[model samples]
Target: MSLGGRGDLTARIYRQIRDAVLDGRLRAGERLPSTREPAGRLGVSRDPAGHAGLREAIARHAGVARSVRAGADDVIVTQGAQQALDLVGRVMVGPGDLVAVEEPGYPPARLLFRSLGARVTGVPVDDEGIDVAAIPDAARLVYVTPSHQFPLGVPMSPARRTALLAWAERRDAVVVEDDYDSEFRFGARSLEPLQSLDRAGRVVYVGSFSKTLLPALRLGFLVAPASLRAALHAAKRLTDWHGDLLTQAALARFMEEGLLARHVRRATRE
Candidate 1:
């Protein structure tokens, strides 16, 4: 995939290697020069975690807005929320692993887990949210849209949130919290996200800017626990290396200047 950016020397070299691989000119298992030389020349290592500026902005904004506890290093930028889920699946799911999704949940997440060779099961959702008791014991990953239940639009009650986290800890499973569209709330303030409430670091909080910004921008991020950070970073590198740095830089500036919060406030009022 084209990591869209200005054609710097590094970008040109990356493109050459990419083209050669795609054209079958660079066969697998062939040794090539290490990247240390180019990395030294550029004065920056190839970081799969994504743009530093954007990750810092996301950490700062999410800390205040979502009550999420994280640092810039904990954030992994993705093409969108969908890609965040994909990376999580890549790290956590294996063939025949049990994966659970909320009934009538986000279809994309369900399909994603299934595509990763997981045995997907749907747990029932009530007004409070997905019934923690209904989740399978063997599930290795549970995907939930707790802030605003997908298709049902009900915020998970605080009690339910606590129960779900406890369940995850007891089951030794990970929870994927898709916080998509929670920024557009029109009623009471959103309950604490599972990420904020989690003490065991089992929640992978996934968020997207598609509702707040233009969907075509394809910006999103995930706040992963320390335990999964390395695996998630590796998965991201293998998937796309990184995203469009130019867009990430623009978004970072927008957030750092407080324009993003201002836009959200105006959107909420309207």
Candidate 2:
């Protein structure tokens, strides 16, 4: 970092900028000064792009998109759920927006929402999960884990589910139902998702194959409301275009033949 008297100032400056971008200190589409200006500031010679290419490389590793949807629009493959959280926050929440999240839920979700310029309110969670009545007065989105509440590990109550749907309908708040790790439930009869019971067209279901499939799979899904499905699908498209089509086709066959169902049922009832 001292340049070691070898005049490697460009590499050092490149690294500094790269680290900031990768660490979320510099977000997607955030502008970097011209190569000459930074070099002047750093007492170095002029250059081109000021490591914009390196910054883009850092973004590629961070999995942050240049565009909101990132040009893929179909299936998004993140390094992990955390990166997905970052993506959702970056794309979904804007400044001064209100986003409702579960109380005592995952901290990273809260961070992601806040990072996206949302005023995040924590909705209380009971043994059965988020208390829909605890939702704030005016919120644009309700992000929940209706299938399996994090840490607490209890599915939302049926009545509360209906109540949430009603609330979303009245307030026009989009409901994002994260069914993370639902496939590995250790319980009785499997419960259907709030997405499945969405009659009001407000629920968006999200799931990851991290638990059921290999860690490197990185395949997650967003089953949106009929109205939002197109947009979110476009979001997915712009993000990565689609998951590996061959893998999806093969998995579709496996699921249709009852492979995933049997696996879920067995995992739950075992």
Candidate 3:
């Protein structure tokens, strides 16, 4: 029988034995090993946890390359940028909380916010990015792809970026800056990241290796404010315990050895 089949049988047998013992049908000195012992023998374990090395590497890269000041403590390794979004939605968004997203934005983000009971509002986007003036006054959270607006490919202008941050501060709102494709710039100088421009701790920067390296890797991270770091880590732990350890370790080595930078340079030139 397959391993799964054997596991099922073992569980059934263990339950039966427990019931027999409770009913005084089995002897006190039973020879059966505990369920955990057998599971351990089978090499099953809890979900993979995030690696510290990878988190540190990510913090270093973001600080050095993207001008985002993130420490390992402020980073949460997620399955991808999508999960980072989900985590933010879970922790920060409450029922009926207003969430403003770009109007033709990434569909998954809108759906995810809605699933968490947020009243997601679509704000129109133009060449300058999501129009800050159009954001609802009651919005508690704003999600934007400012580095390179999704699908439309327009970078959020510097003036608009400042306005958005100011609006977030005035409204007591949080801004989720999805820096998904900022690493591969074509010609123009990269605009300062919203997180870097943020002085009021309102921006949560989300990044993914999917666009830069490979989507199959499903590796991404969130650079949250010091205040939100604990809650984000708790949310991450509840959702998936952590991300894949092997992939994180490998990616950490790739980053530390400068392999990722080299690859990006080569790929951008091509």
TM-score of each: 0.85, 0.62, 0.81
* TM-score attained by model 1: 0.85
**Candidate 3: misplaced stretches above 4 Å?**
1-49
Error of 3 at 128 (Å): 1.1
lDDT over C-alpha atoms for residue 177 of model 1: 94
Q: Give the CA lDDT, 0 to 100, for residue 132 in model 2.
A: 82
Of 1 and 2, the candidate ahead on lDDT is 1
Which candidate tops lDDT? Answer: 1
- lDDT measured at residue 229 in model 1 versus the true structure, 0 to 100: 94
- Ordered from best to worst TM-score, the candidate numbers read 1, 3, 2
What are the Cα lDDT values of the candidates?
Answer: 0.88, 0.61, 0.84
lDDT measured at residue 98 in model 2 versus the true structure, 0 to 100: 93
Off by over 4 Å in 2: 1-92, 256-258, 262-270
Better of 2 and 3 by lDDT: 3
For model 1, how does the per-residue alpha-carbon lDDT over 120-201 read when each residue is reduced to its tens digit?
9999999899998889899999999998999999989988998999999998899999999878887888888899888998
Give the Cα RMSD of candidate 3.
Answer: 9.3
Tens digit per residue, CA lDDT, model 2, 1-270: 122223345456777688889898888888886776776778643311112222222223212211112112223344346555555555567898999999888887788888878999998899877888789868888888877788788888888888998999998778877767765656663466776677777775555667766667555544444465344434544555434544544444454455655776676566
For candidate 3, list the clashing residue pairs, or say none: none
User: Where does the lowest 10-residue lDDT sum fall in candidate 2?
Assistant: 65-74
